[model samples]
Target: MTRVLNFLRRPFVLDLRALALLRIATAAVVLTDLAIRSTDLEAHYANMGILPLHVLYERNWNAYQVSLHNISGLWQIQALLFLVAAGFATMLLLGYKTRLATVVSWLLLVSLQNRNPIIGQGGDDLLRMLLFWGIFLPWGRMYSTDAGRTEPKPAAYSYFSAATVAYVVQLALVYWCTALLKNAPEWTTEGTAIYYALSLDQVLMPGGRILYQFPEVMRFLTFATYYTELLLPFVLFIPVGVPFWRMLFVVVMYGFHLGISLTLFVGLFFLINMASVLGLLPTPVMDWIDRQVRTRTQRLQPHLTRLSNWRSPVRVNVESSLNLPPKTIQILHGLRNAVVTLLLAYVCWWNLDSIANPSLTMSEPLRWFGYLFRTDQHWGMFAPAVFKDDGWYILDATTPKGRHIDLNRKGRPLTLAKPASVVSLFKNDRWRKYSENYLFVSNAYLRPYYCNYLLRVWNEDSDNAPVRRLDVIYMKEVSLPNYKVATPSREVLCSCETAPPAK
Candidate 1:
């Protein structure tokens, strides 16, 4: 029975030092994401921006979702929250009060995403879920402020728990669910998914443009991508040659995501995915990394000592435990384990719903629980087929003197011609995501708000290019086979006229 239990736990054993690395990497990502989002505080998070608080409550907000950003619509308030979130992320990076920092960071991330659902993508979900599981992980057990100067024992190098299982299974589910949702022939037999994906000039990077010229290469890569997403995750749990299999999985995924990052404008999606698997690297690799780090630290010992002497000695000890009876402590631990197991099961069920089969459907009643924790996720990115409707926005506007201007080009003359690089038009990937959502028929209500926001932004210095009306135009370019390019059609997505200059 002991042997059997050990076998069962083998694949789930996580290297604690790797977990510590993951904690630091994830926290850095949180800080980077926050900094990027901060640039558009008024535009994305504030009420006077693209989505007002009332409009969000009416159209986009759900009952189970919560956001601290909802407390005030002002950019200053949003900035304050961003700063607070950044502070927590910093604490998490240093592993000072790690569990607490992780929990708060997860909360703020979910709140920020919920506040602007239109701008979210699969990466946001992955980041949120990683932090959620980190709350239960002993990632701060080594190489952290919480760990202090105490070195870990050999046994402490590895950890096995319900949270570790959840983390592993969660990553597998992301790839598997995304593959399952991509039932379209383009991802399977046709093998044109990559071709179409790269064809999207809106997201085309230099690598994609170069690769787009090679159709045969695209088809081969398309098959590789699909099969990798489908089959590679299972390698992570193989019992035989455990370390070899784990290393193979990690290496393959690193290349896979790196390939994606090179060919697409996915922003931090690849980085987050890559970070999610850092803790899954085999113990030997982590051991090597530890040795290298120790060597480097020794080299800098003198400098570090000087710096340490100048700074006041401050150790943020996070070691606190209840002095409960043995039986009570056991009960509490079991309860915590049970809750994690249950949550992991629920997350699987939630992901199953993405397959879109009625017989395999997860009950709606259980979803409120997932949403309450903000663990509800969808992995259908470029799935069921890549988006064929590729386009660039034209913020076509009319001046008070009836002159035509394009706010998207910063008050330049309005022209329907497509830009040289549509990807460059977006300020960041978040805005690119919002623009993608805006094209969806279901998101038609989002158009007027965006139009109004652009108009307001343009007219503040009305003397230069005062506008009476603004029209949000979309130039739709559908991907065609045989390397054919479809002619783009100009469609007026939204037209908003400002209330006649205070009458």
Candidate 2:
């Protein structure tokens, strides 16, 4: 029993340095995500944008959802929250007030995601789960301003606790659950999922254009992709040759997401996915990385020492304020352990329920906790099946002079011809995601907002022709088997008029 327990624990032991890297990478992603979303502050967040506060509350919001961003309609307020989130992210990146910084950062992220979920994708879910698990992990112990004094660095530089177990298990569920959700014939029998995915011209990257030419290669890759997601996650739990497995797992994921980035227009998804596995970098790899950066490390020591000194007084003040008796601290730790355990159980159940597990199901009331913390997730990227519909958007509009134009092309001459690259029609992945969501029958209400926004933005420019009418046209093309292509269909998704010259 003793040997079995020890063996079971090995998979959960994580390198402190790797966790530190995770902290820095996660914080960087948060800041980078903020920067990307900031570019569309008014258009994506404010009342003036495609989704106003009222519309979000009425249509897109969950009952348990909470968003500070939802409290105001002004973009200025949104900007202030963005700045606050950025500041906390920087604190997390530096490991200054590390736990507090992480908590605030997670809260802000959940709030931001709640504000505009339409632009969100699977990567957002992973990032949120990372921060959630991060709250319970001592990831700031090394390569951080909080380092050196928290606890003596273990000889192996490895830490194992309930939190680590939760982290490791959580990472596994991301891929395993995603694979389980992919139950369609495209993934298993037909082996044409990759072909269908690449058929999406709106998301096809430069690499995909060349790769899709080989049908046999695509079929082979589809099986590899499916099995890779399904089986590789199990390797993380293998105790034998643990470090080798961990290293292999990390490398495979790095390559996997790298391949996805090269072939698809998934903004920040690949980067975020790659960052998710950083904590699995084994001790030997970390040691080599440290050796490579030894000189640079030496140069930064002085500054780090100064930072530690600068934070000492703040630390002291905090310790004095909440300095509970030893008994109280012990009880608090026990309570924390209980909470983490419950959360872990809930998350596992949530994933199981998501895939409609035959024997297990979670009660709806229990999901309130997940929604409140934004821990509820669905990793179904192209699951159940790959999307068969692949298309591009055309913002067809008629000018006041009765001349026609395409707002998607900055009011260029209206033509049915597809652009050189359908993927280029989207300004960014957020727009791409929103456009994808816009095609759904349930999201019909979102169409007019996009239509109105496009018309307004296009008409704002003095040089632009004033439009009498505009139509959101989707040139829909379905991916066909045997490398056969479907004829593009012009679907008028939404139509808007420019208020008939202000009545």
Clashes of each: 0, 0
Q: Candidate 2, which segments miss by more than 4 Å at Cα?
A: 1-3, 148-156, 304-331
lDDT of 2 by residue, 373-400 (tens): 8889998989989888887888889877
Which candidate has the highest lDDT of all?
Answer: 2
Q: What are the per-model C-alpha RMSD values against the true structure? A: 3.1, 2.7
Query: TM-score of every model?
Result: 0.94, 0.94
For model 1, the stretches where C-alpha displacement exceeds 4 angstroms are 149-154, 302-328, 462-464, 501-503
Query: Which pairs of residues collide in model 2?
Result: none
lDDT of 1 by residue, 272-333 (tens): 99999988988899878877777777767665552221111123322214456778766777
lDDT, each prediction: 0.85, 0.86
